[model samples]
Target: MSTYSYRIVNVFTQGDDPFSGNPLCVFESAESLDTPRMQALARQFNLSETTFMLPSTRANARVRIFTPSYEMPFAGHPTLGTAHVCRALGLAGDTLTLEMQAGLIPVYATQRRWTLQASANGPSG
Candidate 1:
């Protein structure tokens, strides 16, 4: 049997409301899980987005974003949530870079707030 660890967080929260922001699930570690398993887990969580953390050669860590139906190259809330989890788990510091399918993303944290640098080009024109 295999046990996976994960954390649930709210991004873009307003005030102290727990349900104020978008909910995201971030898997603490996904080095053993494959694409199919990751997809299934995302479907099981049924959140707007789920993130898996993996080791990265180019950045602090590698992140994969997934929805119930398919995988996403990148997403804002998920990126922020994952960065928060990374910092909590000692995987990264206040400023770290995440390697995503879309590209390498730079994330920064100030206190409890997290931010990510967006790409110049949009997904679609």
Candidate 2:
């Protein structure tokens, strides 16, 4: 088997610079986060959302969004947090098109923040 690498991130999603409340849990990777394991962590952390990075052909990573109970097609916070983590690891470009089940959602990074939004005409990439 091939070796895979990933990281777990804690994101506030909202609030001030210092941050408050529970930080969102994320298992970021170029491969994939263990499915059952990621679910378990979601339960343990109990954040609004969590992210898993999967293999992708896009310059941006293929990402899966999950809640504590089930996976999601798309989510604002999870996308942002995932982008932020990836950028921090020097995996970012001016723009990234995350391959989500919903579509090829584009995320752009500016200064120190990451933002994700959907497009009606976006390709299923």
Looking at model 1, report the run of 10 residues with the lowest lDDT sum.
116-125
Output the number of the lDDT-best candidate. 1
TM-score of 1: 0.93
Per-residue alpha-carbon lDDT of candidate 1 for residues 45-97, written as tens digits (9 for 90 to 100): 99999999999998888999999999999888998999999899998889999
* Model 2 Cα shift for residue 121 (angstroms): 8.8
Instruction: Look at candidate 2 and tell me the lDDT of residue 106.
Output: 83
Candidate 2, position 53, lDDT: 78
Model 1, C-alpha of 20: deviation from truth (Å): 1.9
Give the clash total for candidate 1.
0
Candidate 2 TM-score over all chains jointly: 0.74
